[model samples]
Target: MEPTSSAPGQLQSVTRALSVLGCFRNGEDLGVSEIARRLDLPVSTTHRLLAALVEAGFLDKVDVSSRYRLGTALAEYGQIAYRQHRIHLAEPHLEELAAITGAKASVATRHGNDAVLLGTSSWREADGHELQGLRLPLHASALGKVLLAWAQAGEGELARLPYDSGTARSISGPAELGAELARTRERGYAFNDEELVSGFRTIGVPIGDEPGQVRFALGLRGPVELMIDERVPFFVDLAKVTARKIADVLR
Candidate 1:
């Protein structure tokens, strides 16, 4: 078997411990033998690594089965990393958009077949509820459509379609979703006219490090009265500008 670490001295122990922790997935519980088999390590070494990780609060040992799973420490660290990397980088731009338009502004990144909200900003105090982990349907929300449009270019097809309908207007077929994505590409933004929720509208533009490669989407959403047809052009322009600003910061 290959050595766990290339660094000198005790760093090897740290590498083995990390490897042990990495073996556990979101809903999986593993014993030392399974981890050792996966890592091509001996049972005794794997048991030692697991013991250290459990003691250090990186893994938790189940009382009944004696299996190991990821601990709360990893989740706490993950939230910190997510805040520093995604939310901190995108919040300023969202705030600027929300301030200019007097609506809710958000940043989302593609997660599987959904757009996962990373951060949001709103001028209204009552609208300040957290939406950090919200997942919007790819075939329904403006933010999701923008990401799907860009991803389609590389994959040569849309993500498997006919997603659960968020509203009567939500796209319900592959062909319908394909056409919407085409329109999104041509118009340089995606628009949702009460597609996700009744009486609500949103416009979203992709954020990218370069042309034609989207990393995330920036969006503005509000009541239909405030996001009427006449106001869509202005919101689209604002969303695109804010997306560009966020891309610059991320780069």
Candidate 2:
């Protein structure tokens, strides 16, 4: 078992397939042509990859359209991962928090330059807002800010962020984000005042006891009117309590 001649080819195929799935990070149903363009691969090669994924139940083709969307297999795997990470244990707490605060309550972890939602509960109607599995920009999301602040990330790491993305109200540069992180640390929470989405605000707090050892963050999000400045302190207090409860269970 010294080596296999086809190992490199198999590795390349696996990488390509993962890249294709990563292209759907925004939860969009994509056509073969669009996926190929994004990956800079030829149409024939992309089509083959799509066919394999469809056969494996990782993706499903729309009946009336050529677009492809995530399949049931991915959902099954997502649930398995959720339970493995003990995120499912926080679902009930998040739901209670959402009900009490009348906003979206979620737990997230830093994934590279983004914050990936692990669990979420919304008080409002299901208006096509799927917070779980969604990636929020670090500089533009309260959860991201809390994670970055508690982690005490270095300047080089901050400089590599996508500062130009997100809403116009987002932090424009690393220096600005550094100042914001300092404020977040001082306040013991992070605030996203329409930095990620227009007309919505979020408050975030660390879940763990130690400062730089924080591994997760809890967030409460709602519309600007509902999450008014006058109510922010109240919301932050409740969120901190809920985060502590969740952390206790995780430990």
Candidate 3:
């Protein structure tokens, strides 16, 4: 098969470089032979691609070794990526939640199959940062469940997917998950208590009037004690109120 170029300038070079970079996802520190074999390109082509990517700061080659790893250009790209218009707009809402809850509040959306944080008011911002870009699981988080339930379309969409979990407390299988999603749709929110990571919990509501179709999320995060304790129902109500406010602003 031939690689398609979107335009003429440096397309082939870019394609080859991307292919080499993709080799890192399932494994680490690949040398020329592995990259060439995985990408099915000639070793010479792979070497040239690696050289170009390394020069462009997209890949790094450690001294005294022939292996390659991701480089600074990707980090720069990530920084650039987190500064989109939507992320900027969502900050005020995240800030409101953070101020009220005195914890981390953020906005997220489906980035492919993963939930990507778009904006945040985390506890660490006084040290000179905000939660700009972080990917979280959609299958194992309160935010993730909200995203998925919304994606389910509220019309028997619940029954179609497999809903197994990575943790013990999670719904055991897809059938049960479909039923759980049915409930989530009824309540207009979702919760995760130590589901993704032990001792971490969250309550997330969709950013739009509708669920899965919403482009953003409002999330509250803290220790499990705070989320699962008596204050949780109140916090969920707070999150829902805040979500309605966000939807009104966007509407």
Candidate 4:
């Protein structure tokens, strides 16, 4: 007689396959043995799963190393998930914010050590920056700073500050970034003055009220001349209100 179990063999296979896929880290590749060791599974089982994933277009094998990494299929699914979880909920609010501010508006969510732009809104005649589907450095972009500031404090993974330079004003050290994050937390917003892009400025606010636990950020961007110190307060207020609206919809 066949053995009884809480999960059927097919379901177990599906779970194991997903676990194998999960082992591929961002910017890192893995061979079958490494994956099997991580999953605590037999080498033969891991190889079978990897082959199946490669066949299904869920993973790609490197020509030189024979290692496996995430494939285009994951990116396709990621975009779909981003649309469903973020873009659909944020579009109306971002549109209204852009209309009200006469500036570019965008929403972003943290992904690994980067901020992924999910949606953007711009005035009809405005030549705003197109950033949807773009991944930006966490220490340079206003939206990235906002998300990073609100990440769980003392989380070692979040503390890895790879301060890639976007402009001369970009944060270059962990100390400076930590101070900046502190200020962002205190002010309930983050500002980037030509840090990511020369001649442009941006301000961002978190979507939720809880500190150190934000999942989304809303931001406004415009030329530095247009987003002057005198006008920053107004834009910040608008961003906060719009963030609240988006949060309401998300909730």
Per-model CA lDDT versus the true structure? 0.79, 0.90, 0.71, 0.83
For model 2, give the RMSD to the true fold: 2.0
For candidate 4, the lDDT comes to 0.83
Highest TM-score: which candidate?
2
Residue 95, candidate 4: C-alpha displacement in angstroms: 0.6
- Ranking of all candidate structures by their lDDT, best first: 2, 4, 1, 3
Give candidate 2's whole-model lDDT. Answer: 0.90
How well is each residue in 136-176 modelled by candidate 2, as lDDT tens digits? 89999999999999999879989999987778888999999
What's each prediction's TM-score? 0.66, 0.94, 0.69, 0.67
lDDT of 3 by residue, 2-24 (tens): 66564665777777777777677
Compare candidates 2 and 3 on TM-score and give the better one. Answer: 2
RMSD of 3: 5.7
Q: How much is 57 displaced in model 2, in angstroms?
A: 1.4
Question: Which prediction has the highest lDDT against the true structure?
Answer: 2
Tell me which of candidates 2 and 3 scores higher on lDDT: 2
> Where is model 2 poorest over a 10-residue stretch in terms of lDDT?
123-132
TM-score-based ranking: 2, 3, 4, 1
Per-residue lDDT tens digits for candidate 1, residues 1-251, read 87857666578778878777767743589987889999999999999888888787888999899898888888799789776775687787888788888789988888777788877885464233433237788889999988888766442356455477688888887778888888988888899888887777889888873455787888888877788899889888888788888888776
